[model samples]
Structures are given as structure tokens and as C-alpha cells.
Target: MTDTPIFQPGDALASARRTLLTEAQAIETLAARLDDAFAEAVRLLLACRGRVVVSGLGKTGHIGRKIAATLASTGTPAFFLHAAEAVHGDLGMLTAQDVLIALSHSGASQELLTVLPAVRRLGAKVIAITGNPQSELAQLADIHLNGAVDQEACPLNLAPTASTTAALALGDALAVACLEARGFGPEDFARSHPGGALGRRLLTHVRDVMRQGGAVPRVPLSATLFQALEEMSAKGMGMTVIVDDANRPAGIFTDGDLRRLIERRGDLRGLLAAEGMSRNPRTIAAEALAVDAAAQMDEQRLSQMLVVGKQGELIGALHMHDLMAAKVV
Candidate 1:
């Protein structure tokens, strides 16, 4: 008997290409179908007085969790609840003022169907995202947004491929739409992602991470190099800003300069800050974001930078260590 042949290289490549094209087509179909139902769903969610309760099962549950996270991070308060878990007592998390968004490709997820009635009975608004608008979950919802795809990207047409992607994209659209309607800003996004780099960039200002006022390692130009070194040691910032009599930043001295001076056998006690410091050192505005200051430090190849006010007066200092501690870089 002849053995069934395995897929050849050309066949495998063709199959992958077909799958990608199929999924892309499915996404296009889903996008074109978006309309007023999408708007209504956004309105219902916005009108909600409490958190959005997202529920689904199987692959839909994974999609639901992402949708909930997107909603939460984009200004909407939301959380995911497994429908099966909800029926097993997690339903207590839902409240009368909450809005329920149920995800099911068939609009007939048995677990969601089982607990959805309870969600509605509790006076929560129910919004369903499913491929079949005529399916039971859609019929039960107060608002229904079609997440229909033309077909599955799976060759067997069984696995949740194109359908799942379509649903996930639709949910993202809803999140962004609601986010725009609420005028959600970077600060609001940062609040939801406080532990991430984007959050640090948006929330960390110079004031939050700078060595301020007396804590800044600063000295007048007339101060001896020994005094500047002492100030740098006391502040533990590895550098010192040299200011003029008017308190304007005139120059900077770092550990590197001190090393160079020592190598040249220069007397640390006899040299003044003006004679030893690097004139017109790279500086940042006091109001600059910590991330911007970090970039400036990187570009200048410096471990520390001076923070100056509008009139170029030294207000504080930023060190690479401070940026690292604040996660600004």
C-alpha cells in the first residue's frame, strides 16, 4: 500500500501564504461591517456607572481577557470573568451598575449562555460580540456588535483562527473608540500601566526624579576644586554644577574631569571651579520629562546633567542613576 505523502516545501509555503491572505480578508470583511451597533455598544459601555465585566469561554476567554485589559488601560474600568467560573460563584463580582461584554464566535458559548441571564437579571447591561448576530447570545443582549469573519484561516476550518482575530480586532476598535470619546490622555494610560516604561515616560517629570535645591551638587565658580569634589562626594551624584554669582549655570565638573586634573598633577585646592569645569555643559530644562532628560544624558555621554530654570539658573541635577531608579530610560 502506498504511504500518504507529507507536505512538500512548496506546499507548506503555499499553505502559509493562503492562511495569511485568508486572515487578512477576514479582517477586511469585519472592518467593513462595523456600523451603528458598534456605536451603540460604545455608548452603553460609556453610560455604565461601574466597571465593564468581560466574559467568554475557550479561545474566546483569552480574547476577552485582552479586550478587558485594553479597555482598562484606555480609560474604561474593566475586568475579565470566566463564564464557567462566574456560574461557579464568580458572578458575585458583577454589579447592577456594571456592563457585561460577552465574546463568542458562535454567539452560543454554553458557559456564557448559562450565566448571562443572571448578569442581565442583576440589572447589568449585556453587550454581545459574536459572528452570528441571530444566535442566542446576540438575541439576549441589550446591544450586539457583529464580529463576523468570512471564514477561518485554519485549513481544516475548525480551529479559532480568523474568527478569533476578527473578534479581537473588533474589541480593540471598541476600546479605542471609547477611549477617544472620553478624551483619555497619556496620563490616564500611565495610571493603568504604572509599572511599565510608557508609564514612566508619561508620569516621571524632572521634579519627581531630580536632585533638588540643597540636594543638588552645586557650587559658585569661585569655589575651589576641592570644594566641588567635596560637594560631589556629599551629594553622591558623581558630578557638580558650577554657577556664577547670579546662580546661573556656568559650567560643570564631573569625576572624569577630576581624574584628568589629578593625572596632570593639578592642585585640587588651588584650582577654582571656573578654571576646572567644562564651560557650557549640556543641560536640560527643569520642566523636561525624565525620559527626555535621559536621552540628553545618553546623547552627551554623561553620567549626570544639570537642570536649569527658564533663565538658565541651576534648579536641580539629573544623574543616570536617578533615571535608572525611576525607569525613565
Candidate 2:
């Protein structure tokens, strides 16, 4: 008989669904298997004084690199090393203070086994992540994280699928746990990711980018439209805040308001600031996050807002331009 199989509708779809279920079920099993060994690995990682050096071969190596990156970005210092390259002098990077994480799906990767002894000799403890907890790699490790899965998504069951997924999930769990224990917060994450939108939202506070001091446009409620217009022009923020006797904001007269007044009154040059201004304008705190300010402005369909102090006194002014300049928009 010929080896070629017959084609059919939905066959590929059926296979894909089966594969996903297999891999997802594998992770569930791994979660159930989590025991003291997992805790021990976490403790060792937390106690490590130096970096986490991850080493693996082949497909395991790809997973190892991703794990190392996640750990590093989340506050756990980590870097990836190839087991094949370690024997060639890369092992020198490991020291007693560091923790060596070895990933081997079969628990019998020769390249990894070849360098384990050398790393151990350097005083570094080993944490093995493998599918076979009873294998030689596991036996040699100071701690083992069981990454066992029943079978791979490959129809032939020869390729690494469920195993690699389990390994990656376990790695993420470890990184997040360490992150929480260390009190790593958004501000710290922003420091590491200074170019991302999330970084701008967290690191760029309202006060850092607000127009303050004399740069803020202000006019007494008793000021005429002509006087308010001059204040707005001088401040260059396109708006002027009208303050009450207590120095709290009572209203705002924007260039938009001036245009509307000209259209309706036909003689705004003689009107008082209070008669032409929008009353009880939206306001934000000077210490609030720039992200919150952006959200507030977007929600209100506003282009400019007044920044206030804790006691509701106007301290600064911000426009959509300011948020854009700060890269928070």
C-alpha cells in the first residue's frame, strides 16, 4: 500500500483543535504537579545574590531565552547561555553567587550535562527544568521543576509541543512570583521600559509636564473680555482661568469660548470674562499621572484642563499639546 493518506474536509481543523487541547491539558497537569520542589526553586532564585544564568540546547534553548528575558524585565536579573557554547568558555560567566537554570526536555541533553559539572565547581547551584524528574539531569540538580506532559501536539508524537508549552508556563509563573515578592511595581517597570507607552504613562507625572507659575493664564472674574483675551495671548495656553476670592478656579474662558461669544453676542469686546466663560470647568490634580489626565480629557472630549492643588487651588494648566509633548498621548 502507498504511504500517502486521503484528503478530507475539516481534517486539518480537527487536528489543530486536538493539538491545542493536548498542550493546554499538559499545562493543567503541570500545575497540579507543583509541589515543594517548585517552592524550593523559587526560594533558591530569591536567595540568589547574583544573576540567573539559563542554559539549554535546541528547542529548549529557545524557551530558555524567552524565560530569561521575562525574568530580567520583571526585576529578576537573568541572561541566557547556550550549553554547546558553555563548554567552549561561556561557563566562565557563572559564579558561586549565581543560580544556573538548565532546561532539557529529555533530561539527557549531553551539551547541558557536559557543562553542569563545571558550573557546579564554580559554586553555583543548579535548578533543573525537565520533563523527566527522575532523569540524570534531575538527579544532579539541587532542585527540579517538573515539566512533564503526556504527549506532543505533533501527530507522530515525536516533536516537542506540550513539553515546551509547559516549560514556558512554569517559567512565567516563577518570574511573576519573584516579581511580587520583591515589590516590583509599575514605576520600576517603567524604568526598564522607558520607550514604551506604558513607560510614559507611569513615569510622566502631571507636575513634570504642567505649565506652572506665571506661564499659567489667569484673569479675575471682573476682567473684561478684552483683558482676558490679552492674558490668554500672553500665557500662550489658548485659555485663561478665572479665579474666585479664595484663589480657586471658578471658570475658564478659552479661545473657543471667545469664538462662540463673537458669534452670539456680536460684541464680546465689552462683555465681562464671567459672562463669556464656561463655568465650573473640568480640572485635574497637578500630582496625578499623565495617563489619567489623558483619559480624563478624552472622556470629557476636552482639549485643555486646569491643574489644581490639594486644596482645589489652581496651580497649573495643561493642554493636549502638553500631553503629546510628554509622549503620554
Compared with the true structure, the alpha-carbon lDDT of candidate 2 equals 0.91
Measured against the true structure, the TM-scores of the candidates, in listed sequence, are: 0.81, 0.83
In order, the Cα lDDT scores of the candidates are 0.88, 0.91
RMSD of each: 4.0, 3.7
Q: Which residue ranges in model 2 land beyond 4 Å of their true spot?
A: 1-9, 212-224, 230-237, 242-251, 259-266, 271-275, 278-285, 298-301, 308-315, 324-329
List residue ranges in candidate 1 displaced over 4 A. 1-7, 211-216, 219-222, 226-238, 243-251, 254-271, 276-287, 297-303, 308-315, 324-326
RMSD of 1: 4.0
Cα lDDT tens digits, model 1, 290-323, are 9888887888788988888888788888889999
Prediction-by-prediction clash tally: 0, 0
Per-residue CA lDDT of model 2 for 252-302, tens digit only, reads 999899889889999655689889899989998877998899999999999
- Highest TM-score scorer: 2
Best by lDDT: 2
Q: What TM-score does candidate 1 reach?
A: 0.81
**Which 10 successive residues of model 1 have the least lDDT summed?**
265-274
Q: After superposition, how far is residue 31 of candidate 2 from its true place, in Å?
A: 1.5
Residue 271, candidate 2: alpha-carbon lDDT: 85
